[model samples]
Target chain A: MDRPVSEAQTKADLGETVLFKGAALKLDCGAALEDIEIAFRTYGQLNAEKTNAILICHALTMDQHAASENPLSGKPGWWIDLIGAGKIIDTDRYFVICSNVIGGCAGSTGPQSLKPDGSGPYGTDFPVLTIADMVRAQGLLIDHFGIDSLFCVLGGSMGGMQALEWAATHPERVFSAVPIAASTRHSSQNIAFHEVGRQAIIADPHFQGGRYYDGDERPRKGLGVARMAAHITYLSETTLQQKFGRNLQDREAVSYGFDADFQIESYLRHQGMTFVERFDANSYLYITRAMDYFDLAADHGGNLAAAFEGTKTRFCVMSFTSDWLFPTSESVQTVRALNAAGANVSFVEIESDKGHDAFLLDEPEMHATLDGFLKSAAQARGLNATKEAKDD
Target chain B: MIDPKASAHGNLASSRIDLQLIANRVEPGTKVLDIGCGNGALLDLLVSDRQVDARGLELSQKGVNACVTRGLSVVQGNADTDLSYYPDNGFDTVILSQTLQATQKPLEVLSEMARIGERLIVSIPNFGHWRVRLDLLLKGRMPITGSLAASWYETANIHLCTLRDFTDLVDQIGLQVESCITLSNGRAREISGKPSARHNLLAQQGVFVLSRG
Candidate 1:
């Protein structure tokens, strides 16, 4: 590891592995996992009333290193742009908490975490987790801090799924929820992409049936291919065509062999190779499965409105126009359900060519929308008037 | 003031006479849903001035952004399609301000509005104004006036109509006209003595509050 964050740096950046001892997490398939260590990072201090807490849920591959310095790459956190001292989220104002989900490999109790008895990694022995299970585990972490409710719960993609579930399962806890670039359920195309990635990992001989941790050989090729496929889903065709197009990687002519000739090919290969270094293969399988099975409506007796019936929590549902993975139509359907359920709701279909990953990138309109939404919500909750009086 | 943008003009009501009339009709502490609430000007007026609980549905992102910025609840959605999601009699008053002419199905939208609110508010630009008629007659082409500023080819106002036309539709739909507020050149017009024909010819805008008969 090039940049192993020092003890001082970890404390300074709120990087800590918090194990809620005897943290009992029950899976959707009637299985239970004990001793959950939820790696989380917090920015800003909880107010005296503890009402200014905002829980940020991360996407499929993202960990709890939100708005901090990433220990692995010596770079800023993935969502550093939006959650800084003076950024849209305004860490100076609200106590922001982000936790690595249960099925994650980054210091969380994932399929790759070492068994409690000091055996090898849990690997496939980890019970399958659902989005609700993940939310339930996150609730334990939030409860430990003595926060009765959060100011807001917000996320994009898989993170968005968690935000939706958080509001649905515990409507009283979240005053406002923002679910961006996500839907109530995963589309068939999403499942298809996930299935292809799983198959790629399974096809590798070195995978060793998800028990690759037993030997020195890891499923590098298989996991790399899987990442390559999954990364394409995160971006739009316009982005790829604009970034790479038919440009050659290094030469003027095609290689004519299996070697990468196009710049897109080389880019995907680099993305795949770099990803496998930090992420575990079995954890990827588990997380993907969790995302694939997330259908909020199906769980609520096939009535989407029933999931949010009589919900008093305010919602801001957003989607990018070019995000085909979770299109504008998906957000519209969600807004419809919220309206039918008489929920306080707002929606914005942002015009952008950045696709599903637009929520992570620099979207000025998105920032404005979020800033406006939160500011209004804060005022409604008396957060603004209180802080102003304090300053005065 | 440190920021002039944050200052509320003490007398928030602007020269939009129809808006003033609509604002005057709204009671305190009632629920209001303003469709196509641009920049949330009227909703903000209602919220801050009238103390009425206000919500909004705007079709454009910019509109929704402005509404949210002003601390008003506004969703981005269309009138023709998304109105069906709202439950019946959810709001005391549902206002469609100067947006009736632009709707794909104005009648259907108004019908949905009637169902969603106890009182339905609609403001339609008068296509039968004397200037519009004179311009059409003399120029031999589509007329573009101050209220209907865009060219016929480029305009988003697909179902433009006159005061008489709208009133006829209201009658056809079995709606009782509670009151009619007429405006001309951003000034309120008195319609008590004049006939409906004169109101249709002179008025540039008409704000109507209708109830299902």
Candidate 2:
């Protein structure tokens, strides 16, 4: 029922794609998929003891280029500021592994991948995946490296869901975990937002029942609209007020038309337009659906503590003050469960005006908190400071 | 004497008069939770010296952040509100160091601590010490001593208690005092008999080890 990694194909930007030729990945929905491919990138060297490997789970719309430049956007990695030589994650001292999650289009087996019958892309037919399923696929990639346990499993938002899933399902393999700006389950409001985005994509004229990949025209308008709507949830009213504040876009005054006359409107339009170039519409639908289905406590007899009973993995849960998408109350609920389970856990609510996307931005307080946490965790795990770190 | 190796944690047991006393009563390798653990100095000491599993609940975000930086499992929570979340008898030792006076409801906190911990280590500054009594009697105002240095206007010690008052509450809550120690002018002395006026007047601070009766 399981197989090791095969060097069947290689991909650029997202790194190498390992084909599991005969392995079947069983999903939470009682479905199974075979011939799966996982794309991942590795930074720094795995220590000889192999105890210094750190797995960085990517958020939605992010690829495996965590500390490198992305080919598509020609921009630095999403976490480039925190994960590099002598940085907070400290690539010089730890081996970093970032993989594109299943149902993600960045060189990963997703809706864009071909169907088993070789008819065409799976698209909507791609087996509905869960956060746990994404983590399960990542586990194979971890096994391929012959590492017994990872030093840390870290992420934010949807990626935080994967981190929580990794710890809950494979507690023994995770030495430490940091789930930032996340919750145990998706809220009804979040699910409603996702439904709106899905409806937008499905209603696009070029969608053609999720078979638009072969057509000359893709569902750009629909996917763009979906991205535009989702992008609004990532920011706070304060951020919008301070950054744009009713400012007109390249005009003396408001045009009063449907055009993007305001700066905020133009900004959202740009976010949407750029998103469609690299992301697949069906893939977005699959990823969001997986997140909506994520409820860590549901499978554990409705007790979140039961999921982490007697777990030895250390946890550091964080939230932002302005993050309404995944509020600080959710992190408090998680901390309470960890307390009931008598687990080693820490929780911090960072002061930031940015919303759910604060984890992606450069925050000095967040940086300092993570630096100290990772340093102490590394010391506890007996990971030595690299030569460069020692000098610094 | 201060251990040079412990200086890395900034004075360690000697940093505070009562931290070492609380740390001494905790059994090695036992699960411990320190309520209102400011900056986690005592929790850090217990962790490194006794190798105990240490957790903390800090009221302020700054304190919680500091505790996490030191690798302690700490959450931002209040003593009166957040104690209900922990299960009963979850920790071997629950520590409340110099925080009972500042709590909104001291009795509820004590009862919760008793329920959540098999043994409780509590330290409180005795308000009946001769220095405090004399200062109040002579100055005809609130006392301010080396221990109770904060003025009444700015002090967080709203529910300050004398040694006898604390013991009376302990008995009322059905908690048995396993051992009690008093610190007077940087000296620690164990009080073996029942709580008395003589001990209350002499001791600047009292540290008690209690268990559910």
Candidate 3:
């Protein structure tokens, strides 16, 4: 049997881990991890000037396989549509890098990574992380490539938070930043939802206080339940109604019991079960905690504008109309701060019914806006435009 | 004098009399905010020609998206309500090109423009123009002229004003007119002194450059 050509090409693009021996990553929580490692995948060639590099930060559940086949799932990458040859991100024109963030399970320095002393996986012992910490880890990886400044740093949700952090903390090194479906800080409601997920994970007997590494039975049920609860937040009520709508699953009538009777329930169960197979329970806890700890304004004396004061990085912030998790109002706050700081910023609230997940879905308005913004940024950065521009 | 380079722009031309008049008044390399910048035609001109850091606020989603497609910084917001988000003296010039009359709160919007911008450039269709006056008088009903083409009930220009009424509002808001030009048939000429009844009656539109008193 012959394999697909794209799969063969993507596997070639997939990169392994680059260990930074003796390099210390100082955390926001007063802890430092030395000899950290970053697993990243790259697409396209870096121009001679090294001026056409774009760093794509991944969301909470996304890994480094942004525009390739995931080695684990044997599935297409999350952003395969937006970041390929002649795509909106256009790998043919620029170098695109996506890395598994620190505290993530994907071959990076995380809860699953063994301790330096070789005792076991870090597990629950991983120091509490922040969005800034993840960005700091990424900065080391960029340094290894000898790239002084990224042409653009962009992402959605947690990835968006990192993009903003890169712009705020390392302003000189970022030429542009795009934060989609993100907020300056995680709201209380978001924290509450995360708490519910964490509680569900902790309640599981197999979790063994986050040290399920040695056991054959990892906390699959707990992680699955956590994913199920969190998945509901990613979509809007409208999308749930439209997609499933109290419809029965493989039957004409309700089961009248705790079985997956509704199509929505079955769908959620499948989502949770599949997610558990790929993601670690402890990594989820650390990553969500990091997101909750993110507050760009709090660190700047409660002045969000102070984060980008006198910065030159251009910004484009986007929000979905139906994304109540990170609502349009949050994007408005960010835009207002960018305005107050006298930064060059563009904002677009796209009409999306898919909720926060809209950024990951097929949104023509979002794609068009991003394409135009990137093209303009490329021109400003002096990156040569491709001969054949994708007609978006 | 009309800029020979102005013809290079795709949609922007000397034919957009109000926009050209507004664009000409803006200094190069200044921060500009264009309220109701439909499709960002004027902003595109200001950014390329003047090298100004231009931003826009448009009410229509279609208009905002179009502006973004051009890589111009524009936000979808209403002039009547969204002005408070901007900081004081945020822009060197804030333009309201032919959009003043369409605003729900013309006075508040003007005041907010003055608050946020060091200078405010406003243009409005002159309701006191001879064509509008003649149509209303002769027809004994609401006037419909070239500039005010929409029917009275259908028009978004709820706060229609003449050059004199606009000047009065500017004065009432404690804004001094730095320069004033009356436009008629794609032509613009500076008023020699304070806008009089003659200017109001003859001009189809008026563009005023104002500063806080």
For candidate 2, write residues A118-182 as lDDT tens digits.
Answer: 89899788889999999999998898888889999999999888888988999999999999999
Taken over the whole model, the C-alpha lDDT of each candidate is 0.83, 0.87, 0.86
Isolated chain A: TM-score per model?
Answer: 0.94, 0.97, 0.95
lDDT of 2 by residue, B53-154 (tens): 899998878778878876788888889999998988899999998788888999999999999999998888899999889988899999877656667877
TM-score of model number 1, chain B? 0.90
What does candidate 3's lDDT look like per residue over A1-392, in tens digits?
A: 11111111122333567778765678889988866878899899888888888999999999999998898889898999899988999989989999999999888889998989889989999999999999998888787777899999999999999999999999999999999999999999999999999989999999999988998988888889999999999999999999999899999888789999999999999999999989999999999999999999998999998998888898999999999999999998998888778788888999989999999999999999998889888888888888455586
Off by over 4 Å in 1: A1-14, A116-119, A385-392, B1-14, B69-71, B134-141, B189-195
Q: Candidate 3: how many backbone clashes?
A: 0
Give the TM-score comparing model 1 with the true structure, all chains together.
0.91
- Tell how far residue B78 is off in model 3, in angstroms: 2.4
lDDT of 3 by residue, B1-213 (tens): 012111112223435666777888999999999988877899988988798999988877777777888899888778898888788888999998878887789999999999999999887779999988888888898987766666777776788888999989888999999888998887789975358889989998788999885
Comparison by TM-score, 1 against 2, better one: 2
In model 2, what is chain B's TM-score?
A: 0.92
Better of 1 and 3 by lDDT: 3
Worst 10 residues of 1 chain A by lDDT: A1-10
